[model samples]
Target: MKFLSAAALAAGLCLGLGATQAQAAQKALLIGAGEYPYLPPKAQLSGPANDVRAMTQFLEGYWGFSKSDIRILVDGDASKQKILNAIQSWLPGATQPGDRVIIYYSGHGSQIPDTSGDEEDGKDETFVPTDFGRNGDQASDMLSDDEIGRALNMLKGREVILIADSCHSGTINRDIVPGLAKDGIDARPRYLPFSGSSTFFADARDVEPLAREVDTHLNLSAALPHQLAWETNGSGIFTQTLIQGLSSGQADQNGNGRITTAELLNFMRPKTEAWCQGVEQCRELQFTPNVSPRNEAFVLQPVRPAEPVQTVTGDSSEDVSDVLPERERDKIAVRILPGAMHEIGDEVQFQLTSELDGYLTLLDLTAEGKLVLLFPTDEDRAAGKTGKIRANSTLTVPDPSYGFSFVAEAPAGNGKLLAIVTQDRVDLEDLLAANGTFEPIDDKMGFIKEISGRLNTVWTGDTTNRSVSWAAGYKEYEIRP
Candidate 1:
């Protein structure tokens, strides 16, 4: 009798452990659609598949999600029915209380008239499915935000994370024309009617409403609300940044050796913006990543032992400019005008003066991490605007004659301006190819990488031997609301 009782006790303990393990299981569903069969060839994208693959690898490598537990649907396999079924039926049915669930979607996002009247904006946001029809049957083909909300509502007991790397419209900058050379290469997201068939507008709007339904949601918008999201080299700037943040340990902002959902979003936001705007090869588009989280912060990755910190000290009295050879430093001087607090809508300007004839280029790094080319306007070049500034002459940038100006806007914070003065004409054709042509800067990484390399080369030593003797100066300022 005693032996039988002990055996029963052991069986109960084993069953309890099995149940705990089942409850702790983590599951993920990744969906990406780059090839839209029903849409035009221009609508086809190359980033979605790669985005899914990258996220899957991150989940398996860092998040401890098993390969078998993570389901993937990409390109041809990602249909509306399949997506809906996975979200509404499979995920909720498979996951229980205390379990973690992740759903990631990378593809084109669109908007249609709101039939359910649930959207405050009078338009329903949607993810473009593989079989989305151009003319009709949008109701059945596209996955609406409302449908996603409903599906998420079913998984209220579990910890859920939602990520979307797409935009609903290109209305963010309606006044600004899209594409290079008027070819409309920068197409807006597809728009469909709420019902049968009608015209649609590709405008941008906030994704926070849909995010409210989930425990946590992160949106990697290609552009700000109403702006167009861009693709380059068949991958998304947002996705690439996301992968880097998670994989590189840069997202561990608190140095806690773990990345939380909030930390991940915060890390990716600036990087995505910088990459989209800074790279010369990337289409110059506005991208801002958004996040919505509940009261509690969820850990995206397990905690590991913190790495050792290394600290280095430098002389406080020494000037950074002292590092440069005296000859280079004396050749150029730059300053910002109205050296006072500037509010939004104020015109900010840079003043550059040189001691010798040289080419000049100015670049702005905004508080949001966007890089803007500020000098060598196309109009200036066409009108024989030479970089050659007579010794002791000061040139006020955006000379009003050029009919261009830079105004401060939201994301008010400290920003910087860099002036690069070179003795010889710098070949900036690749960097400025689309300048003044209304083509969005496409290669942001390329621009940042090349400019950084140039800056390092010019600043490291005396350039007396080089054909291009260069000097650079920067000004930091605040943009107030």
Candidate 2:
């Protein structure tokens, strides 16, 4: 029955902003379960409770939520029945039309066999309750995304936000050493049935239907579907950045004295990535916040108007030939055709043609900020097929037979593709080694840095005969339901 202490709640309640005209109440149900009494001791965490506590304070102080309107559930108190009652009965019943409802859960997340067969991935993402059991029957106790979606369907509120700072996968051993005694503690949430498999897939379609019911439904997840969400000290990194972004008004990107759902995500995505890189344990761990907003954009908070600034502009066209040493301008020409937005499921054929004969490399930066090497895959490398394009020749990516094409995924955003043409063959063994043999690098900045370093080492000091050039194209699209 351990909850946020009365004194702590009082402190959160006492902090408030200037009152406005009477409006619909803003209610929040903050659930943080760090202790699993029914599970192993190694599965216990110390960050969830703190996460809820911090969010509670932020909601009360800046978001205009009264102490009475916010419900805090922590650790042992977040049992299956209590959680279901709060979401199903308490939240939906308490809120009227136009009210803003926020449901934040900071805990372990797992997956179970999809008995309903609705999931294409054959699994269902679930939230691990405090009473989660190790027995096979524990699936009944775990809360599935469908159940939450059903509860959300009953809510009368127009603005509903779901923030989950937990990963839906199982244990991951991040130990760097080999053959060392390892603790069974997983940085992620506990898995049911104690199965060794940690593979889990979270599809946006599972909740997209219920989300469309509301006027504005914003779902902010700490990590991508199959990625791990890391915690340090006593709080999740995403929650920490969220609190800071709201409190400091750093998320107000437009400087319009308000923070929108989209603005908050744009502000937090890079900050979370940068912060994760600094953490020793989270360096290799990719933390990409998935922001899915249904319908129209909604304002998250109001801030003081930003100070006005002066405008400055440089010459529209400046010749870089004078600044370059004649070898840096352009020796190889590259082009990507059909540069425009595309449908989610459409097969995107990217055609690259080079004016000079050289090796080609294709890299993609997904909307979620994931860096993937599209060309010269491991298989291609094993086959000794150098990514060479003959002079004035065209190279179609994926070969159509390899079943390779760019298909947009859910939570749509912008994606960029880069084509690098090098006079000499480029070896990726060093890059692969640096990335721990992972195809796509986990950290964006790390990827950029590694690629830049490799390019420098390849093209620098002796470019009299070898010339390297790169061209990039981007696509902005929507993922239709």
Candidate 3:
């Protein structure tokens, strides 16, 4: 695996800082090294190496870091001193008072004795180097989380991000002994007074004998399994989801153009361990975001509707006869009064509106199942932004300030138009709870008595018990024809 040094990062940040203070630099040290060739062959180390390479490409290509601005270090037999030295050297001076820094590690991680004797659990979370040792005397080889934390804290900045793609092994390992080599054990150890053999915290080994130290590491130990889980594909499950969220723009729930460190962590931590049911097995990814808080809650609008998957069996040439434009026209000007329905869309204008920040995509329900953009051609799209329609600001209420439009010639016949919004559905009840109004309408554009199954209705506006009337506020609207 390869790791990027901080010096290269500093150079890039220095250039980008310009008038801005050199306080925070977007820096990352990607380390992917499995104890290969030397240690017994573990899960093929191929997964992590590929993942690290892909990460490097993302950082430099999409993230816009000059190749020279990043450092890459891989250790097959690299020593702990060597790894620490490189970390200290990578992104030299990458942190400033309020600056942000990111550290990504993809390899084997473990919890070891907190030789400092300050931890109540007697165990400190540690990241294994290519040359980790099982010997109690090999102090120089172990990399403790606190040690790294202190080193990172040395920076002028307080906010630091550390991603460990390794799972914590609680010391309850009945299979493998810590001082002695052993593996495989289930069940939490009994909580007891600290033993001389115990390193940091009293229950440090209570979780397991050699279980990944995810439980007690980085102040996340209080949360148990939510703290440390397994890291597959060289990236922890949470880390993988985090990267996807960044790309999907889900981390930016507020629809902001950029993703801050805090955004990534907030979106990833829970999603990472949601699968674990028991407290004993649940793991968490901890973020020590010091200095300024990072709001990664930016919204990402979709570029186009997600295309549907189709399995083609035979020849590509099939239908061409049904492609005829409608001859008879029943035109109706569809308009929602200002603040009436927030947003609207159909064959002509597939506009989408959402209280939560997400993308709007239009899948052609015209039987072709084609994915297309839902918005009209009038709006301007920002970088990393997708979705057919979106709000101008998250702080803004359901006051209909944002909308989009689209137009397409429909085929002749009684074809139904279907579309979906790419965001979490909001509760209409809550919107109504805040004094939202909903009224049923009759053909005469007057209030109706009741609504059900299907209405022989025509032109129902804002004041209708019609299904369209429920689209008052705080929810994404889907238009069907």
- Give a tens-digit lDDT track for model 2, residues 1-481: 0000001111111111011112345678999988888765667777899899899878767665668888988988888789889987888778754456788989877766667777666666778888877454457788877777677766633356788887754333422111112253233322223243454333433332222222225677787654567666677878999889878988887675557667788888898788656544555545677766432244564211122211211211111112222232344433333444544455555667665567776665444435666676665665566677886777886565655555544544434455666655545556644443224566654554444434322122231211124322222223332
Any idea what lDDT model 3 has?
0.35
User: Stretches of candidate 2 above 4 Å error?
Assistant: 1-22, 134-137, 169-216, 279-281, 294-296, 302-481
Ranking by lDDT: 1, 2, 3
Each candidate's root-mean-square deviation in Å? 25.7, 22.9, 19.6
Estimated TM-score for each candidate: 0.51, 0.51, 0.43
Q: Which residue pairs does candidate 2 place in steric collision?
A: none
Best by lDDT: 1
Off by over 4 Å in 1: 1-23, 134-139, 170-207, 213-224, 278-285, 294-298, 302-481
Off by over 4 Å in 3: 1-25, 36-38, 43-46, 93-100, 134-139, 169-228, 233-235, 256-481
**Candidate 1 or 3, higher TM-score?**
1
